[model samples]
Target: MAEQLEPETILREISDLEGRIEELRQAANMPVPDLRATLDAALVELELALTALRTMGVDQANAAGRSATAETERRVLRTVFQDAPVPLFLLDRDAGVRRVNKQAAAMLGTSPGYVSGKQFIAFCDLPARAALRSQLAAVVRTGRRRRTEVRFLGREHPVDAMVTMARVWIRGEPDPMIVVAAGATAVPDGPADDERPTRTATPAAGTAGGAAREAAPLSDDRDDEVMAALVHRMDVLATASELLLDEPVFNENVAVRRCARLLTAEMTEWVFIDLTPPRAGPASAGGTGAPGAAGHEANGDLRRVVVMGQPDEHGEETVHSLEQLAPEPGTLPHTVFTTRQSALRPHVEDLDLLGVCADGQPACVKMGATSVLCVPVEDGDRCIGTITLASRGEHGPLDLLDLGVAQRLGRLLALVIRASRLYQRRDEIAVSLQASLLPQRLPQIPGVEVAGLYRAATHGIEVGGDFYDVFPAAGGGWGMVLGDVCGKGQEAAAVTAAARHGVRALSGWKSDPAEVLSMVNQALLDEERFVTAVMAGLTVGGEGMKATLASAGHPPAIVIRPDGMVRYASSGGVPLGLFEDFEVGTQVIELAAGDTLFLHSDGVLDACDMSRRQFGQERLLEVLAGHAAAPLQEMLNAVEQRLIDYCDGDLRDDVSMLAVRRQPTPLN
Candidate 1:
């Protein structure tokens, strides 16, 4: 600027001046030289072409830095998209593919190079294209993620796909929509776009579609309903379990009835169970007909048949034979009879096949059942029976789970049945033992009318412990004894026999009741076992009947005069086996003519009612008073009836009574 110079030289000088000013401004706080000043200075060198060089150099440097940054960013993005497993794509403002990764290309059955610049709809199959359009538009407007499933048409087949949408921003422009896709096969039936967003669909009214699908709002709302049903099933099973363990109600028939009722209620249908033996005749002969008029053969192998659901018009119950239900020779019912086990027939023309059909006919024109399931009821290792469940109307046949439950139920029923039979056998054995041990008839004694009664306990199979004896005494009087042992069964019966023999042997030694009991006590103590007993000796004299009674831990005897007056002979002593020094206590009472004396074992007072309340001594005494003046047998019968009534028909202990009456001297 200080000298007149050539154009190039002038431009160089101006440039130098501008650089100095800028550097000074950086060192200080002054503003840089203005662009206008530089331009005006450069114009002075317009004839030299120096202005062009300075301007071009600055512009070139700026472009090079920007190009380097853009290249680095593009390289990083390409690597990220290529390695990602999920299908990824970038779309331009016009919803055209700007970039597509390998995953997306493979899904669409095309390459990235071919896919780029193509409209997103052009890549999708017809059904999915419409859906993608709707999803992208919604994503673009809302700036939120949207998702759907679609089917992409491949070169040779179609692939299921899951599409996701969200907004993405590019440099120097508003954010445009981006779409990512995945693939799945578990979609419900519809067009290829079943899971894909429809072309005209609006944005869903909530958060991301992924959140809604994962949580499944409708399914969550119905959870309680499903759980309630599960709880009800569990409750029913628990109730059945309780009933099975209840000894009082564990009857076979009762269990069967309950199980049938439960099944009927649960399935909402009629149920029929026929416990019958297997057929030995030809299948055609035994077909769907009433069992032969003759009762089942005594020697015939018997099997149980339990049929659930109502039979056809001909009334054929769902029948399954034991042999058909068994798995192998020795196996549990549930394990052997699986759900897949079935008896099959090709046509309904055969009688055996017809018998199984719902119509109970051998007509071939009718629609025949495809399969039938039979579950065997096994007890231990032997197949006792079969449980048959049927499918009717339009419902599919039973599966493994259904048959499994039935087999389990059959096993439970078998247990109940076996237990009941065992209980009955035990009861029979107990009654037989008691009858064999006790005296069936009483011996006639001089000057005395005696009647005796013995009743076994009704609780279970157990030989009774009650016993009574009427024999001659030393002084020509009758010795009567009644006593109860402490327990039941063979052991108690053995002790009872010992006690009776000891009393009879002692009667020969002395007439006094106390001396007789002393002898009996010594005899019982001599043996290993103990006994409780009451003994009475009555001698007929000129004036009246004189009686001496002794009790060893035995209840007192009751005497009823012919005049309707009642009295109790109270005598007590320690039970047998208490000590070697123990003694029998005695009480003497004169019986007027026609007086009757009653002696009984403690079992009479220990009887229990249905409510578990005992028929105490007070109740027995009152009963004896009411029947005081009746005939001996009538009095015994009346007492029996009253006892049974008071106990509400439940006798938990044995009862025995011996009655002795002094007849009026025949009025001689």
Candidate 2:
């Protein structure tokens, strides 16, 4: 049992109760009929109780009875607060939620714990947010009660209601908090849903200045709705950027798919992306696709690239069926793509706005979409594609806010697509340029089997500088030249072209390998670049083939016999294009039947594995010896495969190899 209250204390308690009842009466005049009635009945009962208390004055009532009456009044107030008919939020001065009733949590489609500590205004839609912030601050500063309309962004859908806010001072806190009461807006008798006037939100403006303002008058709550929608859109763009840019290489197809999946998660129930083929001409500098603007149609029709829906049992089947529906001309998606503009239809009266599905059912009807928004994917003034967004009844219909967001997203995706295509074109050009630098075919020399291979390093987009050539030499002999320019890309390719052609031309009359290499060095000296090369002059005799090899700071040539015998031939010399009198390493060897010679660039020896271990000369020798008994081309293939496998397919430089084998039986 609690201690008895003094007469003075009892009087103070009566005064507090009377003040609370009066406040309740003032709040009861709200627009909600059910809440007003409840408050009115509670006010009457409270007045009756106060009258009885007054009748039993401090002189008549004992201290213990006064204590019991105070306790009973507290219980009634607690009951009223917890079981209020409408949603209520208790917020600190900063508008941070301190508590939310069950109705409030239900309105947010979340648990009370999730709603607590969050900004109370964040729940309101964008347009309403700024106004709510001002209202909340005004109420806190002035201690005045206020009412305003708000559109709450519920997890499932949006809820529109009128909210009343009042300042509330708690016992332990120095500053007062705010108490917000929200009631559902009552609708007067009206026409059926089908008969209701269709309200279509205007698409975003084309100019920057126009984009800053709303086309239609924004209701107090609508502003908050717009802000919330904008925030959601910005988040989507940030995530899409991470997803698309994180790839080792940007793929347009993968980007669109990822974007579609992301939209289904938080923004919409269904997403469709359609793209036009890349144009041959320069992208058009067309209009902003504002309403009434002429369409900028691409050469090709729009092809459906992605389709996604919210997670459900039938989602996959629905996606697959809808994938068969392409956007024909005059359809919403096609029109948006052609016009480079956006379209927002809140109440989609024309079911065939999107083309029909295979079953002849209207696409929007099958997807259960009440509203749709389509925006063009534009790069600069040219429209590249279209993104169509829809939602089921779980979310509110797409409106002007959604149209603005979709348009911005479409523009973002267009930039990504443009970048991806540009990279692809660059790679293609590199490939074609690199191919043009190499020999189309190696000349067939009787009594000799010659094969060469060139593989570019896989790490970069630029062309490599490794080159090899086989050409006719004096006295019915063959000349082979393999060289590596110091760098890559066009600069190195230019030097490579000069060196390969110089050697082939010089070897025509200069049969001696040393003389041919020395002249080649002088020819490249003006290039002010470095090139390592090994040239071999082979003359077929009635007995066997005599080979003269000259090295210019190049990798040593490997000589192999049929019985797995391996030896190296190297004449250490400075690389070409460095010195006018650089020494040319020269070696002479005779190749009998079933003997082969191998020449390669330094790339094979420099290849590194994941552990950064190099495939050195010792490994190259072992590889050659292991495959010595194989045919010429097969042996080269085996060596190349071993080099790639040793480095786990990561070559540090371009690999080029030339192999010459003296056949056991001479060519007919």
Candidate 3:
């Protein structure tokens, strides 16, 4: 359909139009030409001249009895040759160019016609000419593709090109013609020609200064292209870094998913990330058990975490790989992970996917994948996972250049993944130390029901200083203690644990609440590790319970009557672990049936809302008055939820709440 009208046809029509215009000029006695319209028409005519030349060539080559389909195929091939990324040339069996693409013409500093019918080796530097010819000869003889790097001399200097040769058959020719493809790679400027390195392939990886292709001093234009590509890749890495940095929590799965989203934007059309689970070990403290490098031994199972691709979000790009088994040996991800290297399958087929398909993931046949690449993600020195890539866009199969891009991204993800695991491990260790310091479950006390609740600040990443314990006293009574250490983190949590443990240990010798505080305060000699606590020694009676309380710089206890009246108990003293000779103070109270006593940390009264207003004691007491008759556990739950509602973000400090209620006599 792009076969344009012949230039001669356009010229004849212009001639006929000029004759008509001349007749009009003579009849009207007008000397001025329709110059404006004529000039515009000439401009249009000039633009079509190139197409006219192409159309003329097409007409000459289009033999009679050729079907329309064959003509269309010729047009498609012509279009591809004109716009392809690399130089392409069709040569005779002797390596003389028969037809050359526009890219090849550009390289020769001439038009397509000027480049045709020339020996292909003539463009190469003298040193490479012989080697180039032999490779071409072998490819033509064996009917296989041959790859080599050649330095082709340009008008200004030489350009390094990765050249591939194969035999291509044309319908009218008896012998297959040679098809040569060349991908240009930039070479940095070297010392004035005398110091130039020998033109031979360097490294087999990256396009820049790599063994996969020979090197030569390049022009400034070539240098610019290479520099721009390096910058582009750096930009991709920077973008991925910014995305991960945006999150407060450097979660492992979140990092992988974000990487998949970013890579799908450019790196790969589809990405399948398979992460190996952390090796099994005892949690250091309170961890979610994500393994760190110290526990990097995996059972060799990689669970697919993210699947993303093009055109559609749900279809083709999606994989239900959670139902699949671990990657088996010889599969794409497995081979890459085990070998600790990348694998590029330039062309993929259903037969190559027998193991992949059986593993609950959609096969290449379903996703329409044309090529695959697998790169392993490393954490520290161990490979943590493999990122399998599937590409199906115009970018074609994965090349050495593409592999470089994937490798850089994998390295970035590995660093972040390892850091996230370490952070979680440290957090868990702190939580475990804090947990072991407290009772596993509340001790049941006669005639009283107790419930306690605790929450660490800082999104559970750090241990809170809050602590609580319930244990039996020496004289057939029970003791309950709640305390909060100054500051937070591992150090503060250690002191809080020590304080709770000391109280439980000393409760065996002492039944007095004040004496328990006095002994624990002496043990906490670190001025840096002081605590404010409220201790209670309870003696249960037949119908009610009497509790003697000791306050060590903690908030006063509040009592809620069955009729909803609320009152604060006498609880005020110098906080323990600060002064060497501070007096231990105690307050006694007897609670009737259906009454409750509430003890709390200062985090409640000092908690700030969005408006920066503290939830003061009056408001807390007012709220307690309303929950006076609620069950002990229900009261504790409601109180916690209320505090959470008041804080806009995470709690600013650790919170601990303890409640003691005298259960009503059994109904008869």
lDDT of each: 0.56, 0.72, 0.67
Clashing pairs in model 1, backbone N/Cα/C closer than 3 A: 131-197, 149-195, 149-196
What does candidate 1 score on TM? Answer: 0.53
> lDDT per residue, candidate 2, 457-485, as tens digits?
96776788899999998877889989899
Lowest summed-lDDT stretch of 10 residues in model 1? 197-206
Question: Mind giving the per-residue lDDT tens digits that candidate 3 earns over 462-492?
Answer: 7777888888888988888888888877788
Runs of candidate 2 with Cα error greater than 4 angstroms are 1-155, 158-233, 280-300, 310-317, 399-405, 666-668
| TM-score per candidate, chains pooled | 0.53, 0.63, 0.64
**By TM-score, highest first, what's the ranking?**
3, 2, 1
Which digits, one per residue and each the tens of the lDDT, describe model 1 over residues 1-668?
11134466446545744543432232122112233323432333342234334443332235456456546645655577666656677886456888876666654434568668767654443323323554464455335576666554432134556676666554444334465645454322322432211111111111111222211243542455346434644555666666665667346667776777766555323333434343333331222333333222222233333434443343332233222332232222222233223232111112232232233322111122222345555454334455544332122223344454566666776667656655555565667767765667787865667898887765667788778888877866778888877788788777778888778877886888777777666666755556778888878776478888889888889888776677788968866754678788788888876788998877778777777778887787777777777788888877788889988777777888889887766755
Global Cα lDDT for candidate 2:
0.72
Backbone clash numbers for all candidates listed: 3, 16, 6
Worst 10 residues of 2 by lDDT: 205-214
Q: Global CA lDDT of candidate 1, please?
A: 0.56
- Answer with 1 or 2, whichever has the higher TM-score: 2
Q: Give stretches of model 3 more than 4 Å off.
A: 1-232, 282-298, 311-318, 321-326, 344-355, 359-362, 395-402, 526-528
What value does the lDDT take at residue 456 in candidate 2?
A: 86
Could you give the candidate ranking by lDDT, starting with the highest? 2, 3, 1
